[model samples]
Target: MECKFLLDDFHVFAVDTIGHPGKSAEVCLSPNNYDYGIWVSDIITALGYDKMLCFGGSFGGGILSKTMCVSPEKIEKAVLLVPAGIKNAPAYKLLNMLFPMIMYWITKKETWLLKCILPMAISEKNIASDTYETAKCSIDHVKIKAGMPSDVNPEDMKNYKASTLVMAAEKDCLFPADLVLPQAKKIIADCTVYLITERGHMHYLTEAEKRMIVDFLHDN
Candidate 1:
């Protein structure tokens, strides 16, 4: 959604991840390894950019993390918001969402959908109109992806050279701040982190935070 800031400031390419639920090829790379990093590295090569400033959130954040490991030199900088791969909460933390999700799938009722997403969003008001629309469409038509990227290996991260900024949500049921930050700071040689206070996995960025992200990525 920060594409507007990126568009205003830099040359941008909005490449959809090849395996995701968008119009991309209907194939998902294994989330357990660095195959996605290899895929992204090839994209950078094909795009003729030796280095890139990257931004991604949630699942995209996981892919970016993989890219940082696969070819660190190719990334000029990075920003990951409410990201996966750095850390993910245990399955038990998410158990509350399962029944609502199943009911939504079976019944296609908006109430069940909202109930399912509220655990992630933290509040009914936190769900954006477009987010709601997108979720509804994706669930109605596409097979939902169940896996988030696995946490990155500290060893694989050792050679990462890009200055990285990770924006973690404090109360996110998945990838909570406590779980993500220590590893981010340890694995990245030049890492900066911002904790989004009182927020969960699906809250919107404040105007100030939006500017901060644009400035961080644009600085290099």
Candidate 2:
């Protein structure tokens, strides 16, 4: 999704995440200044948003959800879409360590790797020609956070108190519904988990999915 879209719709303030393009981890790592969570906390205090709603797609979802664990007092609600924070899982932990190595080895032709991996990791029905481009665009945008950090501990996830909504695609190979469904139940025992039929790992928020999220927010 585009940043301008949110700016037009909500009182949106976008802070580029680390590891993506345009955002530098060095700056974001400063607790006194720009650490992702700290920066968000600073914004909340400065803007007088004592309780903010958190929403993220893909990796953004992972970071936003973790922020709820680390700084739960600042969040009122959370929405995660194909979020990537299940560090406790072996496959994910392996991906975190291997991704950099794989990237280095693949060189400029890295885009090819995404084409293969996205479909294999996610469900077959969700793969599309545009999916690789979209994934590459996001990688080119969000900065990488230090700590080579990946994966959210299951315990921290279980402790989160914010009203939560998680949507996963039934066909998503990258972050499958099987993993996500169980994680959602553990993270927020009472929250609703909806599976998007015939969708994949792509980040295009569909009208129905958007409506579901809006409804969840309205109810909670």
Candidate 3:
């Protein structure tokens, strides 16, 4: 994704999650332990940031949640975008995501499988051709391990002190807004929640949603 919009305003430090596809190390940290938090903290320290505003989406959101629970002092604020770890994904959602992938692997027909999955997984219907191509390439080449991140414990959420903004997609079958929003409000102390009615798990934020996020990051 092109983040020039965000980079134009703020100095963004983006890192590939370890074990995920990217130039980062191939070590996958266990979600059940503090290793993810520690690894992130080490990166922040190395970057010379005493405290930074952190934003994460999907699996990265799970890592951010873990960091908040274990090392809240390292983060000044946080934004979670359709984050995982709030609740386990429903079986149908998993099947919806996995079936197309399996078909693509067996058939080697990336375009057809992506076309089938996009409507079910992503919110945007009119995606750019380049974006679609990039996604297709990544999925075809990337080596990702199977397993969802463990759910964030309620006590951990309660212990996090940083101001947090959790944006949940209403059509997110993976992490339904109905299930995530209420639990987030009940746990995080200074939390703001937005249920994006037009979005799904793979969100495509509207102009207004983008403004809301920018305002929150700057104002809070």
Candidate 4:
């Protein structure tokens, strides 16, 4: 069902985020500033949409945080899946990944790539083939992101009133549910959080969970 969401009656619109792949400026916007939110706001206005539902995961969720901070009124509802920008674990926690990543960069070996990703996914079983391949290709090609978006000031989110859904994983090395859920509850006014028990960052959703997300997003 998720596969058919691209051009179905729900009219889901996917935009290539600025500075990522596809048609966007070569410049990477600063996550700490309001630039990302402004860019998103402009896109919404340019498309002549008064309000829209939004979905984002991981790095993209951080960008959505910026949008909520900048243009909360423009969003009808939001689903943040394994989102960032709430409380990202410090970079030191990720030192285990550095060696394998460098080795992969140096050797361009798929084995090394797997090693590079293992820490995030926690186990090979959690790493879907498509997820692995996409990460492999993206890493080989896309320029590395500079940093995660900074924690949004509570005051910045004071005006955000859109109903929001957050799905966070318990063992996410980068944005653990312990960190993300509490803050999400604290900052988002009308928020619902679902913890993916025992799962890490790369865990896949069950079909029922996938259907739940689709249903939520489809509810205009």
Candidate 5:
């Protein structure tokens, strides 16, 4: 698991939460209990980072939100993309809880499981060729070795206090904007929400968004 940021100027340290399938790098402060927010706090103190801005995408949003909740003093500002801590759909939660256990048992049947899991994380129509390939690579790794658990209770989100700029995809199927934005607004009254047109759950750094994010980090 790798948690690196593309920052040419200033220090940007990315923290990975548990059960992130190499996407999030899963580093926690308390290795025994693995409390996500406490781990984030530990990371800040351990790394000697202070009054920093944060940017989180997908499940990284969940971890960042938790990080703010646990250590609100550390975060100066935050930009969240497709944050995944809030559970709007009951059925999705059930499946997410079961995925790791089921994957462990069905080790040989990788393709079938991938088909089931991929659709949950992305819209069927927007599953780009490169995205599908990357997802398959990660899913294949999970099939071979069941990943860690990164699930967070909704209460943790309710406790966050960061002033956040949250963006959601209009056509996102994995983490719907309608559902997540409301939860974010509820969690932090200072949160601002934006719905991007025809985007997916993942927020990649194209030339424009990268510049926007860099400017945001610098200004904040």
Candidate 6:
């Protein structure tokens, strides 16, 4: 979504994660092993970039972390946004979010489901009619797998060589900022962490936040 902001200043490659609803082949690498790292590295090599900045959010963050662990040399810098793999969603939060969506899936109650989940998933300031419609369409059509990515091993993370910027959403149910910050600081050799306030799992970045990210990438 921030591609517009970066387009003039950087060459952005927005890869559709495999198995998500996109043109990419539906071949998911196992998150429990190094397969994800290998898969992403192959893509980068294919794309002909010797090294580049990598930005990932949510599920993409898990894949990026795996890449960082196994092939840090390929990344110039890394930016992770409320990423998975730092920790799994707390069980109660998972159940609360999933139960209604599952019921909607079985019963085909689209309106009811959106109402139930939107407040939990998005901050009030971030809500927009167009974005809401898009998200609804994606959920309705996408064939998604139903599990949080496996957690990253702190031991593996010690091998990471790239400078990293991590932005964690304070209200993020999937990966709480409080939990992710400490673990990231412990593992990543050169890391900067920011806790974004009044944001949920799905966030809207203000101009200041956008500028912060651009500055980070440029500085690194």
Highest-TM-score candidate: 1
The Cα local distance difference test for each model comes to 0.87, 0.59, 0.76, 0.83, 0.60, 0.79
Q: What lDDT tens digits, residue by residue, belong to model 3 across residues 199-220? A: 6666467778787778888984
Q: What is the TM-score of each candidate against the true structure?
A: 0.96, 0.68, 0.89, 0.91, 0.67, 0.90
lDDT of 5 at 36: 66
Q: TM-score for model 3? A: 0.89
Ranking by lDDT: 1, 4, 6, 3, 5, 2
* Residue lDDT tens for model 6, 57-120: 8878888888888888899999988888887666677666676677877887876677556645
Q: What is the lDDT of candidate 1?
A: 0.87
Given candidate 4, what's the lDDT at residue 48?
92
Query: lDDT tens string, model 5, 1-220?
Result: 1123445755766554555555655443332123666767777778877757777776667666667666778888888776655433344444653565366347746555455545444545545566666666765565433222243444645655657787776645656777777776776757878776666554443566656656666664
Residue range with the least summed lDDT across 10 consecutive positions in model 1 = 1-10
Model 1: how far residue 113 lies from native, Å: 0.3
Model 6: how far is 185 from its true place, Å?
A: 0.6
TM-score of 4: 0.91
For model 2, residues 1-220, the per-residue Cα lDDT tens digits are 3223444446766666543555455344432111455555666678788887767766576666557656778878777777656422344534543565357346847655554455534443444556556545655554434342255555665556677888776656556777877777776655678887766665455676676676666664
Which runs of model 2 end up more than 4 angstroms from their true locations?
A: 1-9, 23-39, 87-149, 157-159
Q: Poorest 10 consecutive residues of model 5 by lDDT? A: 143-152
User: Comparing candidate 4 with candidate 5, which one achieves the higher lDDT?
Assistant: 4
Looking at model 6, which ten-residue stretch has the lowest summed lDDT? 119-128
Query: All candidates: CA RMSD in angstroms?
Result: 1.3, 5.1, 2.2, 2.2, 5.4, 2.0
